[model samples]
Target: MSSPTLDDAKRRSTEKLDPERDVETLELAPASEYYVSHPFMRKLLSWGVEARGILPVPREERTDTQYNRIFFIWLSANFNILSFSAGSLGPAVFGLGLRDSCLVILFFNLLASLLPAYLTTWGPRLGLRQMCLSRYSFGFFGVIVPSIFNLASMCGFCILNAILGGQTLASVSGGNLSWSVGIVIVSVVSLFISFCGLKFLSWYERLAWLPVLLVYVVALGIGGKHLINPPPAEPADARTILTFASTIAGFVITYSPLASDFTTYFKPDVPAWKIFWYSYLGLNIPIISVQCLAAAVVVAVPTVPAWSDGYADGNVGGLIQAMLRPAGGFGQFLTVLMALSVTANVAPTLYSFCLSFQVCMPFLAPVPRYVFSVLATAIIVPLSIVGATRFYSTLTDFLGLIGYWASAYAAVVLMEHVIVRKGRFASYDLRYWDSPRKLPTGLAALGACALACALIVPSMDQVWFVGPIAQKTGDIGFELAFAATAVFYVPLRHLELRFRPMV
Candidate 1:
C-alpha cells in the first residue's frame, strides 16, 4: 500500500487530477493492501458509498471544521427518552427527593462531562477513531479489552434505548402494538441512519434534537406542577447518595470511549478550547435539564394516582404517558415522538460500535462499516426483545458496570496524555496506529486496569454481587477505580517509557 506523499498531495492540487478519486484512493488503500491494485473497487470507493472503516483518515481528506456542530451532535445524541429514564431512577428507585436528585444530576454530571469533553479534542488532532487512538496506550492487541467492553456497553445501551422506545410506542398505541415490535422499529431506524455513515449521522443528529426538545418542554410543562413541595423526606444515607451518584455518573461517563469517533473529520487546527466547551456544554445541557425534570416529576409517582398506575404498567414509559395524559391527543403524539427520539441516541452508538469491531478485529477492518451496523442491529433487536421486561434492573446493573471500567479507562488514558506525554499532540505517531511494534507495550495500562478492577469488585453495588465494602459504603467503586488507575498508571508508564521507548 502506498501512502500519499507531499508530492502526491501537491500534484493533485496543481495538476488536472480528479481530487475525489485521489482522496478516496488515499483513504481506502490502507484498509487492505490489495485495495490499491483493484481499480473497480477503488472507483466504487471513490463514489463514497462504501463507508470508511478503521483506517486513520489522512489530514488532506479531512475538510470538516464546523466546531459549532459539536454542540448539536452531542445534544441530539443525549437529549432523548433514555436520559429521562435515567433521571427517574433517582427518586423512583433510590428513594431520593427532587432536590437531592437534582443535586446529584448537576454536580456529578458536570464533573463527569469533563472526561469525554477533553477526549473530543483528540478527534481532529489525531484523525483516528477513539479506539484506534487507544493503540497509543493500550497497544494494538491490548485495546481489544476496551473494545469488547465498549461493544458490550453499546449493545447494552441499545437494548435499554430500544426497550424504552418500544414501550412508548406500545403506550401510545394503547397496548395494541407489542413492545417487541416497537423495539424492532426503533432499532431498524437507528441502523438505517448509522448505515449512511458519519456525514449523514452528523446531519441527522444536528436537527434531531428540535422536535425532542419541544416534546421535553411540553412534558415538563404538563408535569412540572405536580412536583411535591416542602420535600418528601430528609436526604438519604451516604451509601444511597454515593450509589445513586455513581449510577448517574455511569450513565454520562460511558461516552468517554466514543468521544473521538464523532470529531475525526474536523480539520486538525480546530482550537482545543472550542472543542472542549462545545462538547462539554453540548453533553451537559440536555443531561442536566431532562434529568432534573425527570427527577422532579418522579417524586410525584407515589403521590399522584395516575403516575403511580402509569409506572406500574410500563415502567418509565408508562409513567411518562400518564404525565402527558393531560394534554389529550397532543400529549399522546408527543409521547410517540419522544419514543422515536431514541434513534438519535442509538445512531451514534451503533456507528461507533462498528468502528470498535473494526479496530478490534483486523480482518473486519477491510469490511465496510455499514455491514457492521447491520450486524449490530441484528444482535440488538433480538436482545431488546428478550430484555424488554427487565428495564430497571438492566439499567442499574449495566450502568454500574460501565462506571467501573470507563472511569478507570478514562483515568489511564488521560494520565498517559497529560502526565506521561506532557499533553503533546505531536508525540502521537498517527502513521503507526496499525503497527503493534511501534506502540506502547501496554504493561502499565493493563496493570493499572487490573489493579483498579481488583479494587472495584469489593466496592461495587449490584443485584448479583455486593462487595463487603460496598455493603457499608455503597458504590464508590467507580471513584476508587479512577483514583487507583491514576496512581498505578503514571509510575508504571514512566518505567515502561524508560525501558521500551518507541522510535
Candidate 2:
C-alpha cells in the first residue's frame, strides 16, 4: 500500500540519529529558478500552466528576520474594519462594557495566541505541512481523522468569509447588486489570488494592510470629533468574565492548526521568542484595534442593534457611506478601502486550505495548488449561493460549534508538542507521511478525541444542539471541551506510551 514515500517516512525516524542522512539539509536551486521552470506565469494569463505545484520551500531560499513577516500582515489584513465590531460580539452578548470588554479581550487574546505562535516555530525546521506534522501523533494513516475535521472547518471558513465579503461588496455597490453576486465576486477573486501561489500572497499582504489601516484612522478621526459622553463602565461579574474569556480565547485559538502553513520559509534557527512576540503582537494589535472600535461605535450609537455583520443598527456600508459622504471624493475612496479589507481578509486563507487538501490526499501533490483552489471554490460556490442566508442568519451558533471542535483539537496538538515532541523539530520526509508503522499508533489521540467530543456535548449550547448541562452551567461547552481534552489526553497518552514507543 506504500511506495518510496512510505520508505522515506520510515527512513526519517532513523535518519534523525545521523544528521547527514537528512535530505532537507542539502541545497537546491533558488525558489525563483524553480518558479521560472514551471508554467505558473502562463497560467496567470491564459490558465494554460501545467506546472508542478506545492514544492517544499528550499532552505537556501529562506528569509532571515523576515521569517514570519507575511504571517504578520496576513493576520492584520484579515482583521479588516468589521473585525473591530465583530470582536464586540462576545462582550456584547454577555453585557460587558467598553472598558471591561477591552480588558478581557486584550488579556485572553494574548493568552490564546500562545499555541498558534508556538506552532509558527515549527515551520522552517520541518518544512512539512501542518497536517503532515500530525502524522507523529495520529499515525501516518490515522491523520485522516483531523484532516476530515479540517476539511469540514474549511467549508465553514470559506462560507463565512464569503458572507462577510459579500456584505462589503454589496455595501460598495450601493444596493444595486445582490449580496449573492458579491459572494461570487469575492469567491472568484480569492480563488484567483490563491491560484497565484505563496510568492504573490506574501507580496499582496505586505501592501494591503497599510491602506486599510489608513482608512480606519480617517474614520476614527471624523467619528471621534462628534462623540458624546459615554455610559459608566459596568463592573465585571464571574459570568461576564468567564463567558468573554472563553469566547475570545476560543476565537484566537482557531488559528492554531493553520499556524505553520504560513511559516514554511522561516529558518529553523529563528529565535523562538522572536517568532512568539512578532506573531503575538502582529495578531494582537490589529484585533485589539478592531474590537476597541467595535466598542467605541456601540458606546456612541447606544442603539447599535445587537451586532450582525456590522449592519445591525448601522450597516458597515451604510454607515461608512453616510459618514464619509461629506468628504466627496475622499469618502468614495475610503468606502472602497473598507471593502478591500474584506477581500484582504479572505484571500490568504485559500493558500493554507489548498495545502490542507494536499495533506489529506497526497496523490494530489503534483496536481497544482491552483487546480485544487479552483475546483474546491466551484463546489462551494453553490453552497454559498443557496445557503448564504442560512449561514449568515445562524452565525452565532455556527461559530460556537466551530470553536468547540477547534479548541479540543488544539488541546491535543499542544499536548503533543510539549509532551511528545518536546519542542525540538528536525527535518522530515513528507512524502511517506502516510506510512502506517512509521507513525504513532493513533490509539491515544483518537480515543481521547472521542472522549473529548462526548465530554463537550453536555456543556454545549448551540442553535441546533444545546446540552442540558448548559442550561445550568450557562453554556460553557467550549471552555469545558478545551479543559476536558487536556485532562483525558495526558493520562491516556502516558498509558499509550507504556504500551508502544512512538519511536
Candidate 3:
C-alpha cells in the first residue's frame, strides 16, 4: 500500500522509454521542494500537459466529467480565430453585407461544425489520435494520405496563427515592435505550452479566458452603439453567395480533423450527444457572434484602414484597433489581451501538428514529443513571416485546400461510423492498425478523396490553381464534393466490409 519509491518510478519510466516500441514515458516527476520554491525550472520546462500520445489513457487517469470539460472546450474557441474581423470574412470577401454575412456565417458555420461534433464522439470511445483512427480507414502505411493533409493543415494553423500573433503584438506596441519580433515571441510561448504538454494547455485555457473575455464584452458594450446604423448592403449574385458560403464552410471544416484531439481525455461513457452539442455550440456561437459583430463594424466604419504591410488591407487588427481607439489605455490593454489570446490558440494547434507527425511516423515516436513541437514551430516561424503579406488570400486558399480533403475524409468516416461501424470501434488495437492486410485497404477513402479533389479542382479558384469551370461559372461547377463522397463512400465501404475476413 505504500507509495511507489522514486527509484521505482524512474525504473518504470526507463522501461517505457524503449525506442523499438512506439512509446514514451509521459509521466510527470514530482517537483523537488527547491525547484518548487525557485519556480524558474518548472516555468522553463512547461511543468505539465506532457502526457502520453497514442497509448490509451488508462481509465483511472481519465479525469474530466462531461459538463465541466465542455466549458474548457468552449473557452478554447474564444480567440482571434473567432475574432470579429476573421468571422466577418465569409461575407466580406464576397462583397456581402451585414445581414447576408451573418446569415451565411450562421448557415455555413453550423453546417461545417457538424463533422467536428460527430468526430468528437470518437475521442473518448477510441482514446486514440485521429491519425491513428485513420489507419482503420486507410491501412497503417496508407494513413500517410490523410495524415499528410492533417499535418499540413495543422502546420498551416501554426504559420498563420504565428503571423497573426506577430501582427497582434506589433499592433499593440504602436510602431516600435516589428512583425518578425512578434512572431518569435508568439512562437516561443506556443512552443513552451505545447512542449510542456496538454496538462499545461488545459490549465492555461481554463484561466486565460478571464482577461480576454472581459475585454471582449467591454468592447462589444462600448461599440454596441455603432452597430445601430449599419452601412448599405452590397450586391451579390448566386455565384458570389455560393462561392462565399463554400469558402466559409471551408474555414470551419478545417478543424474537422482536430476536433477530437481536445476531447480524448473525457470518460468513455460520455454521451455522444453531449459531445456533439458541446463542441458544436462552443465553436458556432462565438464564431457567429464575432462574424455578425464584425460585419456590422465593417458597415459602420468602412473607411477604418486595417493594419497591413504599408497599407490598410482591411485586416482585423486595424478594425479592432479602430473600435477600441476611442477607449485610450483600455484599447492598448485589449490589444495585448487579444494578442495573448492568439498565443493560446497557437499552443493547441502546435500540439495537434506534432501529434499528427508522431502518430503518422511510428519510427519517429522514439524521440520525445517536445522535440517535435520545437521542430514544428521552428519551421513555421519563417513560413509565417513570408505568408503574412497576403494574409487574407493565404488564409482563404489554405483553408479551402485543406477543407477539400477534410470534407471528403469526414464524409467517409461519418458514413463508416454510422453504417459500417455503428458508433463503435475496436478498442486500442495497434495490431489492427500496424498491419495493412488487417485493416481496410483504404480504397474507399482514397477514391472518395480523389473524387472530391477532382470536383474541387474544377470548382477551385485560388492563388495556386484556378479551375476553368470555376473561372467561368462562379466556381460552382454544380458539384457538392462532400455529398458526393458521402454517397460514394457508403457503397464502396460496404463492399470493403464484406471482405473484412479475407485479410
Residue pairs that clash (backbone atoms under 3 angstroms), model 3: 49-197, 49-198, 49-199
Per-residue accuracy of model 3 over 295-324 as CA lDDT, tens digit each: 776666654333222126755665566566
Best by TM-score: 1
User: Measured by TM-score, how close is model 1 to the native structure?
Assistant: 0.91
The local lDDT score (0 to 100) that residue 394 gets in candidate 2 is 42
Question: Model 1, range 1-503, lDDT digits (tens) per residue?
Answer: 66443234323432122232221112333333323345655664565543677777666666797787888889998899899989988887888888888998999999989999999998887678898888889888988998999999999999999999999899889979999999989999999899877878888889999999888788778777777473566758988888999999999899999999988889777788999999999999999998998887777777789988888943788887888899999999988888999999899999999999988796666566777989999999999999998898889888878988899989988998998878877667555677678899888898999977888999988879989899999889989999999999998888888877752
Off by over 4 Å in 3: 1-51, 303-311, 426-431, 463-479, 498-503
Candidate 3: TM-score? 0.84
Collision pairs in model 2: 5-432, 84-290, 84-291, 311-315
- By TM-score: ranked, best first: 1, 3, 2
Against the true structure, candidate 3 has what lDDT? 0.67
| Residue-wise C-alpha lDDT for candidate 2, range 54-130, written one tens digit per residue | 44554555555575574555465556754653565644466677777778778877777777777777767666667
TM-score of each: 0.91, 0.84, 0.84
Clashes of each: 0, 4, 3
